[model samples]
Target: MTERKLKVYSEDEAKERLAKELPHWYVEHGWIRRRYRTNSWKGTLMVINAVGHLAEAAWHHPDITASYAWVEVRLMTHDHKGITDKDFQLAKKIEEVVQWQPGLEGGALEGTPQDDLRFAYIKYDKPKA
Candidate 1:
């Protein structure tokens, strides 16, 4: 299949979209970025692996910077030399997969127990009121 041409967004435009569609993400330098706080090195690695899987599936990779307690994902359309739909799409997917909490869904898939630090991973962002 032929690839669709990507439209690059200006800084202002990128920030506007991020505000509306990706509230947790921000534009920095030339990339749209989001930092995920983790509980420990294990959590950080989990976040990285999740992002990597989504990025690879989408065929659009983000630059990842990870430490013991956090992971930062930076996305830009390298070929387009700017932010584009590809970046936003991939970022959204990464956010969705990384922040998912099955326990909150009222289903059988209970998420990690909050009482146990050993079971903890990503420090999920709470919804803003």
Candidate 2:
């Protein structure tokens, strides 16, 4: 099947749509970006893998930069030469998958020592409890 031509969003349109649909993401340069902070290197790798899978499935890829404790995801429609709806859709999916916590799922953490492992969920620096 032939792919539909993507429509690039104007700067104002992109900013407005992003503000409503993806408040955590911001437009910079020519891309929409969001940075996820992980707890460790393991968490960073997990985020990268998840983003890779999602991007592959969507057939729309993002520029990813991963470090020991953070991953930056930048999305733009290279074909359209700007940010488009495809970017927004993929960004939303990435946010959902990355924010998921294994401990919140039913019985998934039973008998597992949670403190010893860093999961893929985005977390900020906080005081130890």
Candidate 3:
């Protein structure tokens, strides 16, 4: 099959989309990036695996930088040579899955305990004071 041309967003358009739809993501050097802070290596691995799954499922991989306590995901369309809808879509899915807070929903799923750091993995972003 012939490769279809993707709509690559300009820098300004990318920034605007990020600000409106994905406040946590930022556009930089032709890529949209987001850093997720974790509590330990376990958390870092979890984040990486989650991102990998999403990227693979979406068929749009990201450049992942992972350390003991954090993971930075950078998305861009290589074929298109810029940020495209695929990047933003994958970023949103990754954000939703990686930062999910089931406990806050008051459902049967009680998310990991915040009281204990041992059980905790990802260091979720707290509201600014």
- Point out the higher-scoring one by TM-score: 2 or 3: 3
lDDT, candidate 3, residue 106? 91
- Tens digits of per-residue lDDT for model 2, 1-129: 577788898888888998998888899999999998977887788789999999999999999998888999999999889998899999989987776554556675643244655332457333226
lDDT of each: 0.92, 0.82, 0.91
Model 3 residue 40 lDDT score = 92
Model 2 clashing residue pairs (backbone): none
Better of 1 and 2 by TM-score: 1
Q: How many Å off is the CA of 84 in candidate 1?
A: 0.4
Winner of 2 and 3 under lDDT? 3
TM-score for all predictions?
A: 0.95, 0.81, 0.95
Highest TM-score model number: 1
Range of the 10 consecutive residues with the lowest summed lDDT in candidate 3: 120-129
All predictions: root-mean-square deviation over Cα?
1.2, 4.1, 1.6
Please rank every candidate by lDDT, starting with the best: 1, 3, 2
lDDT of 3 by residue, 43-124 (tens): 9999999999889888889999999999999999999999998898888899899989899889999999977989999888
